[model samples]
Target: MQTRSLWEHTLTFFPQFLAALKEHAPRDATVAVIGASDGKFVLPLAAAGYRVIAVERDPLALHGGEVHLPGTAHAHATGLIDRLRLEDLYDRVQVVEQDFLGSEPLDRLCDAVWTSCSWHYSVNHRRPLAEFVARMQLLVRADGLFGAEFMMPVEARHHLVDHYTSPEKLSRHFTGAWNVLLTLRTAEFTERAHHGRLQDHTHRMGLLLAARTSDHPHPHGKKNA
Candidate 1:
């Protein structure tokens, strides 16, 4: 398990992301987690019966062998599964140990794609962020959604986790019928130095949930007002 600080800067508004998913995707649908570190959301989602594909490159980080990054504990979705007696649920989940950008095109297999504060690392590696995002957009089914929580950067990104995203840039990158469903920017998010050896840091970060539509949906029954 890990401290809640990473979460504080990550998916603080997970419920909203769920609401957006429920509206666009269906029950037991297959979803791919881009950074799918140790199943933070993947485990819970799987327990709920949704088929989850957790994609991670690092052996240690994904299922927790050793914490590569000193300031944080890594994903251990496997541990969570056994501890919770979720071995039966294993059939519904797949752990793909591969680099996100280099993976084969998973055209239209997933009903949705998700990640929590993990996009920055992949996007930075791609360079020219929009191009990378466009490639990622290929994975989702047309009726499906892509939901994520990104930490907005305070200054130049010194580290992968430091890379942040904003609603404006996200909106710009995603053209066509899309919705920036939720955007929350909180300030003075103080993170005390873990051991008092490092200086505490405070800055602004944004949580964004966006979904793409088929340009225009035939105005049908019950609009999710």
Candidate 2:
């Protein structure tokens, strides 16, 4: 399956994602979601009464409106927003179609910054990870939160997988910028033969979740001197 299709599959279990979200975000907190594919994460936040801004890099996908998940055809992200008659809910959300790395700074501080399954494709993974954590540190107020869910490897070798980052390497990248809240690895199962074949050849089936420390200094507007 394509990356888009994989994301669609993942969005079906909103409850799983929500459980994690609640652990990190408070009620009525402001949130910024980067690389928000079809808006799956954004819709839930809207429903839960949190202010959300979802940014996507693919204009075609956004304009295409909604993409139903495979098997169940469940609406996700933009579709969920529309199905729930929550377009007005967008008053609280700001969905933008632009490269997350190249986008302008957000207008206000958020309670949390979330990047679910979106950081692996970053052009310069290390620099962007640093910049992303630093940016989130600036976007989230002191005592606020920053979280990410990444596709990582159990071992340090790059498989035939599309993208893979080692947990240890990722931890080193965030060293002082964020606290390691949770790092759980879950197996990814595939019913399709090709997917299973790919998985067999490539060890591409693990997830990682990490949270940013609250005390980190905001990297906003600091002189480079």
**Index of the highest-lDDT prediction:** 1
Please, what are the lDDT tens digits per residue for candidate 1 over residues 111-142?
A: 77776766566445555556556655666655
User: Residue 206 CA error for candidate 1 (Å)?
Assistant: 2.0
Q: TM-score per candidate, in order?
A: 0.73, 0.67
Expressed as tens digits, the lDDT of each residue in 1-225 for candidate 2 is 111322343323334445666777677777778876656577667768988877777753455443444344444333323422444565767776677667776767777777765666646364545666555556666555656666655454544343465555556655665665555554654334221132233233333344556567655633211
lDDT of each: 0.60, 0.57
Off by over 4 Å in 1: 1-11, 68-88, 156-163, 192-200, 215-225
Q: What pairs collide in candidate 1?
A: none
